[model samples]
Target: MTAKEGVATGSVPSATPTEVADLARVEDRISFLYFERCSVSQADNSITVTDDRGTIRIPAATLSVLLLGPGTKISHKAMVAIGENGSTVVWVGERGVRMYAAGRPLTHSSSLLQRQAALVSNRRSRLAVARAMYQMRFPGEDTGGLTMQQLRGREGARIRNVYRRLSKETGVAWDRRAYDPDAYEDGTEINKALSAAHTCLYGVVHAVIVALGCSPGLGFVHTGHERSFVYDIADLYKAELSIPVAFRTVAEEPVDIGSAVRHAMRNVLYDFSLMDRAVRDIKALLNDDGMADLGGPEENHVGLWDEKVGEVAAGRQYGPDDGE
Candidate 1:
C-alpha cells in the first residue's frame, strides 16, 4: 500500500504524540527541516516528501522542526503522523521568512513549563535564572557581586569588544550591530551575514525549546514575543558562534554571501555540537526540584492579585463572559 493509503486506511495506527515519549535528548531528533516545492504524505511508519527531483522518506519520530516552505503541499494523513511524532511544523515563505503557523506542544506533563513560569514570574527567581544564563555565556567568572544592571552593562561592552575585535581581525567594517528586519534585503553584506546567522540560531534554539516541552514564551531576560526564551538562549551562543561566523563570511565574501554565511554557521554548529550543548544547557537551567509544586492545579499556585497570566489559560476563570 502507498504510505498515505496505509496511514489513512487504518491498517497501521499512527502513535499519538505523547505516546511516543520524548526523546532522551533534543539532538536525537532532526534539528531543522526546510522543505520547498514538495508534497508531504505518510508512508507506512514514516513521512515521505516528493518534489520534481524525487521522493525522500523521513522517519517522523526523529523530526524536531519541519519548515514547510513555498510550493509545499502537505496531506492531512502526513500532518496526523507528523503531529503524532511530536514534530513542530512551521509554514514559511521563501528564504524561510514570514512564518504563518506552528504546532502546539505534544506533552501532557507541565513540569518543565511550570519551572519556566515560576522562574519568569518571581523577581528573585527571574534574576537568578538570568544570572545563570549570563554565567553560562561568560563561564568561570564569579558574578555574585554583579547586579542586574551591571551584568547587562558588562554584557554590552563584551559584545562591543567582540564586534570590534572581529572587525579588525577580518577587515569587515562593522561600526555598530544594526539590522532593520523590515529592510532586510537592503542591508550590506555584513548585515546580511548577521541576519542570516541570527535566524539560523533562532531556528535551532526554537527546536530545542519545543523538543524539551518548554514554553518558548516564558523568558527570563526578554518577554512579550512568542519565542522570547528562544532569543534569550540564542544570545548565549551569539558571540561565540554566530558573530564570528558572520565576520568570517564577510572576510571570504563568497559569490552567494548569504548562503556562505549560513553554510559557515551550520559548520560551526556541527563542530561545536550545539544541538547537544543546547539540550544540556536547557536541562541545567530548568532542573530545579522546587518547581514541582508549581505544576499542580490552578488553585494551588493561583493568587488573588491575578499575577499569573497563564492562570487565565488554565481554564479556571476562562468563562464565556471573559474576553478571549
Candidate 2:
C-alpha cells in the first residue's frame, strides 16, 4: 500500500506510548462524549469525526470514554489513538440502553485486580466489602449486624424514600421504578429519563473499572452477568446522581428528555468529580490496608508462581532439574 493508504489504514508505525504520570487524572477529565451516525479516523494525535454537519477534530489524549451509538463507524487508526491514551470505546444502542465496551487500562500492574479477587473469593471478606458499600450509602449508620436480606430491604426503603421525596418536591407524577429495556419509549417521562441518566452513569463507571484493570464481572453486592460489578459500583451513585437528575429533567418538560438528561448528567459528573471518587472508593472497598492510589510504574512485568515463596522472577533459564 502507498504511504497515504498505510496511514489511513493504521498500518504505519504506531505512536509512542504516553507515560501514565503525564496522563490526565480520571477525576479531572471529561466524563464522556457521545457520537452517532458519524465516521471516526485518526489524524496525527487527534481523532477526526465526520458527519453530514461537518468534520471536527478531538484530541484523543484528553478523552476518558467515547460512546459510539448506532450508525457510527470508527477506523483502526482512531482505535489505536484511543488505546494509546488509555481511553475507553463503548458501543451502545439508542439512548444508550444497550452497551458493549473495550479499552486499555492506565496501569500495567495487576495489584488492584489481585486484591479484588482475593477479597471476593472469601465469604467473610466479601461480606465486609458488601457492608462497606452499604455504609458508604448510609454514612454515620451502623451496618455491622445487618444480614444481607435486611441490608437489601433497607436499600429498597431508602430508594423508595428518595423517589417519593423527589416526586413531591418536583411535582412530577411518581408511581414506581418501572423499566423495560426493549421498550424504552413506552415508559413514563421520568422512567425514560432515569434509564438514560443511569446508562450514562454505567458507561462512565464501566470505563473507570476497565481503566483500573479490574474484572467487571466480579462483584460484591451484585453477582453473575458480565457487568455485575458495573451494576454494584453504579448503584453507589444512582441515588445522588442519576435519580435526582432524572426527576429534575422530567420537571423541565423538555421536547427530548433523554438528550436533556444526558447533558445534565455530564455536567453533574464533572461538578462532583465522580471519576476520582470511583477510583478511591474501589481501592478502599477492596484493600484492608487503606485507600491508597497504589498506582505502579509504566514498565511491563511478569512473574512465575512458586508455592512456598510466591512470585519468583521470570524470564531466566534454570537448571535442567529445576523445571525450566
Candidate 3:
C-alpha cells in the first residue's frame, strides 16, 4: 500500500460513469486505505471521507481496497463510485482484528477464478499448485518430490528458524506462536504485533484475491475456512513482510503496539511493491498454459459452456426445431 496522501474537497460530479478500461491496472494502484469513525461519500472523481476534523477527497480510480473499520458509515453514491472504479470495500473491527464483509471483485472477467477452481478441484493439479506454493518460499530448491506431510514439516521448521533469527537480531524474546482470538490482551507483545501485522496483510491479500476474481475459499494449502485462499496467499509473504516487522515493533515497545505495527506494515508494503509482486506471483502460480501472464484480461464476458467444443455464444435461444 502506498502512503496515505493529502486529499482535496469537492462535490460529487455529474458526468459519465467510469469505464473499466479507464481504471488503473491492479498492480499499478494503491493497495488499500483504512478508515474509521468517518462518513464516506462521493465527491467529483474522488471519494470524500468526512470526520470531525474535516472531509478529504481520495482518488477512487487508483485505490484497490477501502477498509471501513468500526464506527464508519458510507453513502450509496460513494459505493456506486467505488464500484465503478473497480475498488474493493472491506468491513473490519478496530485495529482490523475481525473481518465482517467484503465488496465485489475488481475484475469483470471470471477466467482466473475458473482456472483457480479447476486447479484446486483436481487431485493432481491441486498437488501441483501446493508444491508450486512451497517452491515459491524455498527458491533455489525443488519440492517436486516432497509429500504433503514433508512439506508441512519443512514449513514448520522454516518458520521456527525465522522467529529465532529475528528474535536474536531484534533482541526480543521468542516463544511459540500463541494467541487467543477472543482475548487479544492475553497474547504476548510479539504475538499481538504478529496478529496485527498479519491481519493487515490478510486484508490486502483478500483484496488481491477477489480483485482478480479468485475465490477466497478455494485454496491448495489451506482449506475448510471462508478465507482459506486468503491465508494461503498471505503465508507467501509473512516470512519477509510481517515477521520482521512484528519483532521490530515489539522491540520498540510502543504505547499502542497494534497501531504501530499496522503503520509500519503499510510502509513496508509500499517499499516492497507487494501489490505488483502479488499480482505477478499469483499469475505464475496458477498459469498452466506456459503463457507469459495468466492473470486474465480485464474485459467482461458471459458465455454458455459446451461439452464437445469450448464455450458457446451466450444470450441466444437454443431451439431443437430451429437447429434441425
Which candidate tops lDDT? 2
Candidate 2 residue lDDT tens string, 181-234:
898888899999998898899889988988887888999999988988899999
Quote each prediction's TM-score.
0.78, 0.92, 0.90
Q: Would you list the clashing residue pairs of candidate 1?
A: 3-43
- The CA lDDT at 292 in model 2 is 34
Per-residue lDDT of candidate 3, residues 63-134 (tens digit): 888888889999977887787676788887766677764656666777788889999999999999999999
When 1 and 3 are scored with TM-score, the better candidate is 3
lDDT of each: 0.73, 0.85, 0.83
Q: Local error of candidate 3 at 19, Å?
A: 1.0
| Candidate 2's TM-score | 0.92
**Top-scoring candidate (TM-score):** 2
Q: Which scores better on lDDT, 1 or 2?
A: 2
How close is each model in CA RMSD to the real structure?
Answer: 6.8, 3.5, 4.8
Best first by TM-score, ranked: 2, 3, 1
lDDT of 3: 0.83
